[model samples]
Target: MAKKPDWSKEEQAVQAVQLAFDLSNDIQRAFRVSAALQDMSTADMVRKVLQLPYRRARARPRLTVTLKDEDFELLAQKYRLDPQDRAAIRHRVAEELQGFARNYLTDSGH
Candidate 1:
């Protein structure tokens, strides 16, 4: 003799109803058409719909800086650098200042 499996039919019915309600319009229509012709659980229909993955855009690296508001505004006005050349300009300026200070201090000998 084969034993019958115990099934929670009431919980399954509630889950089916909930999944049907949550389905998109196109999927819901497909589900309804499938349901009318055959015995299909809403969970199965939803699983079919869920085969399409949610696409997320790739993340890009970003730079952020923090400064005193007044100092930031003053620096912005003083430099007025082109966005593209700003890093290069800063590098050149720092190199030149270091060289000048080194020469001046060495020559002074005090």
Candidate 2:
């Protein structure tokens, strides 16, 4: 089932357009992102581009990272999260960074 969007989300879409308009020196490029995000969830669109996981209920990806018990504990304490939650966050962030590098470095023509 498709989720209903809230008003704040709609506003962010508008804000994204405004940002594009402000930043993009070229009208065509500003219009391009604006149009592309139209009829789509702006939050999701930005998150996907930034490689962030969806905010909705999602099955956690299975990713292994070796961390010492002390390190894990420290992270959990600092973030006020359980070990599992900390692991999940770390994995998601790492994946996002990796994807960003791949997309930006390998795909973009500098």
Candidate 3:
């Protein structure tokens, strides 16, 4: 006779919506470290990061900018950005620039 597998209720619940993917070693390490720092499981950290209500402080048209290495370094220093993540650096710059624009427009009555 084959032995039956044992599963907890929480495990069974997660199985219903669980998704799996292969991540690079660096990203996996970062995820695990972040989860440990937050005192949460990697699964919960992933869920929180990906599951969003999608709220924005203001609606603005999207724009892209190209920065040279020196320029990026300057921005990273000024903004204290994470140099390893280009996408995150871009996002932080965009948000800061948008806020400045909004404040300037309001002050100038535009």
> Global lDDT of each model?
0.54, 0.59, 0.74
List, residue by residue over 40-76, the lDDT tens digit for candidate 1: 4444444555773322321332223554546445554
Candidate 2 lDDT score at position 26: 69
Off by over 4 Å in 1: 1-83
Task: Tell me how many clashing residue pairs each candidate has.
Answer: 0, 0, 0
Query: Best candidate per TM-score, number?
Result: 3
Candidate 3 lDDT over residue span 1-110, tens digit each:
98888989988887876578898999988887886666666666676688844323213434557799887788888778766667777888888989997898689675
lDDT of 2 by residue, 8-110 (tens): 9668877754333244456555444553445334444555656777444223433456777787777767656687686565865576668986887787584
Give candidate 2's TM-score: 0.24
Instruction: Give per-model TM-scores.
Output: 0.24, 0.24, 0.38
Error of 3 at 74 (Å): 1.1
Please identify model 2 stretches exceeding 4 Å from their true place: 1-84
Better of 1 and 3 by TM-score: 3
Determine the backbone clash count of candidate 3: 0
Residue 85 Cα positional deviation in candidate 1, in Å, after optimal superposition:
1.0
